[model samples]
Target: MHFVIERNRFVHDVQNVAKAVSSRTTIPILTGMKLVATNEGVTLTGSDSDISIETFIPVEEGDLQLVDIKQEGSIVLQARFFAEIVKKLPGEQIEISVLDQLSATIRSGASVFTLNGLDPEEYPRLPQLEEDLMFKLPQDMLKNIIRQTVFAVSTQETRPVLTGVNLEIENGELICTATDSRRLAMRTSTVERNDQELSFKNVVIPGKSLTELSRILEENDELIEIVVTENQILFKLGHTMFFSRLLDGKYPVTSSMIPTQSKTSFSVQTKSLLQTLERALLLSDGKNNVVTLKTLPDQQIEITSVSPEIGKVTEDLTTSEQEGEEMRISFNGKIVIDALKVIDSEKVNIMFTGAMSAFVLRPTDHKHYLHLFSPVRTY
Candidate 1:
């Protein structure tokens, strides 16, 4: 392969795909990135089984000449070295050419270097999903959905299904749920599809994939086309393509866990309550990191936490509105922080169900997202 490209453009494209590379990959060759030179442009691919990301840089991007191709070929370069070399190149232009079938040369400005590369044929092929079952979501909405739910996925591999976020499509609405038994995060968003469009259910996406997708997105409002199949899901954002392998087994029926009515629901300032808990968590660190909530009459609430060895901490938090009976609840400080970080509202509704049951937290502005936390007993 031979091509002359701009240093910055090359660096940006390489870095984007490199996000999929894993340092602990079982396959040695999978650690490298595949570089394919075609008549239209240069394509770069990186994968680590669970997720694969591909980026394309066309020769002519509108008026700019991004790549000039002299020969058409493909090769796999060490991702660690390739990324560093492209990013730190001294000049505006870069010339890359493959020699002796397994060696590659990259030159820019006053620097020239040659490195050993592997045959692209050794790389695994990306799985393809048909466009039959595809839907579109606003980039901002997709990013929000992933952020709101991915945090709740279990980090431990005790249950395979718990490490994935469950996705269900019905009636032009997409519902995403993530849980680890201790806490649950669910986010729903409307799609831009008509009744004629196809719908799917029980799609499981690994939490790691969703986290990488969130990072890859540049916080845009552009509509993204999502294509799904039995084994794989693809997210097409203009010229780039993101692919993730679906997890096996049925996701738990999370709808049944949500309560239609609550014993107590009150609106509390999101920032104020978050700040109060942040302070209380310091004292509760050694005491199971538990925070006690006492909801009183007249829109007043007391937040307290105590530890036998450490000093106690208490804070009075103000609320916007209160409903139902006054009740007290206790929650894990870590779980509360996880849910509160994603609640993007000025105020939030906290529901106290029972001493042994999970409590629901909802955003006051949007009814699309719900955070449930299983309280820890510290009495």
Candidate 2:
């Protein structure tokens, strides 16, 4: 197999695919990247069981030439070394030739390196799913949904379901929810489903996978195709494809967890509240990351935090409007700040169910986004 590719374009594709290659993978061959050169283009793929990413560089995109293939073949090369070498190649083009015995020789200008390549036949095949169940949404919208919920996913692996974000589609609306038992984040958006009767339940995706996928995706208005299967989800972004395995267990029913009534409801400036929480957290220790919110009768709220080693912080901010009963509640300062960051509106509505129940935070303009935080017991 022999091919010549533009150095910069190849480097970009390699970097994107490398996100799926894990250095700690138990399967040695999975650590390398599979490269297939055909008449159309060259395809690069990487997989680490949980996630797989494939990107193709066409021979010519419109008027620009990207790759030229002399022989049609496939080979797997060491991901880490090959990526580094491609980035530092001397010229504008890279020439790679695979000889007998699975040996690869790469040349660019005066630089030459020989790498032992593996037969691509040994690599695991990616799942091929029927396109019957598919949804289309702008790439930026999908990324925003991930950002609003991924932070609340459980980090502990004891409950595998909580470590992933639950995704469900019904009535042409897509809902995404994430929870760690202490805090929950939920976001809903309308989607254009290809089939009116197409719906899915218990489609839980790992938070880590979504986080990495978001990082690799560019913020653009381009449409992205999402294909869902029983065990895998595929994301098609132009010439790149991303695949993630769905978590096996049933996600907890989170709708019932939302409070139906609240004793106190008020609207406050989001920036002010977030700034107050950030300053208050400075005095909180790692284990005791608690912050207190006291509602004063003067249409103001007091935020405070105390630490034995550090000091105490107290800040007061006037609320936009306060109603119902006045109350005081304690919660994780870090979690509150995380929830606040995703809110896009200037004012946020805070609903509290007395001092002992979980409180809800949501944007005043956008009612579809909700964040709930469980109160922390402070003696």
The clash count of every prediction, one per candidate, is 0, 0
State residue 272's C-alpha deviation in candidate 1, in Å.
Answer: 0.3
Q: List candidate 2 stretches off by more than 4 Å.
A: none
Task: Give a tens-digit lDDT track for model 2, residues 1-379.
Answer: 8999999989999998998999899999998999999999999999999999999999999999999899988899999888888888899999998987388999999999999988899999999988878999899999999999999999999999999999999999999999999999999999987689878889999998999899887789899999999899999999999999999998999999899797998899999999989999887777768999999877898998988776888999999679888798999989889999999999999999978899999899977889998999887
Compare the candidates by TM-score and give the number of the best one: 2
Query: How do the residues 59-174 of candidate 1 rate in per-residue lDDT, one tens digit apiece?
Result: 99889999999999999988888898889889899999998668899999999989899889989999867678888898988998998899999999878988999998888889
Report every candidate's CA lDDT.
Answer: 0.87, 0.92
For every candidate in turn, the CA RMSD to the true structure comes to 1.4, 1.2
User: C-alpha displacement of 67 in model 2, angstroms?
Assistant: 1.0
Q: Which residue window of length 10 is worst by lDDT in model 1?
A: 192-201
In candidate 2, the residue pairs with backbone N, CA or C atoms under 3 Å apart (3 or more residues apart, or in different chains) clash, namely: none
Q: What is the TM-score of each candidate against the true structure?
A: 0.96, 0.97
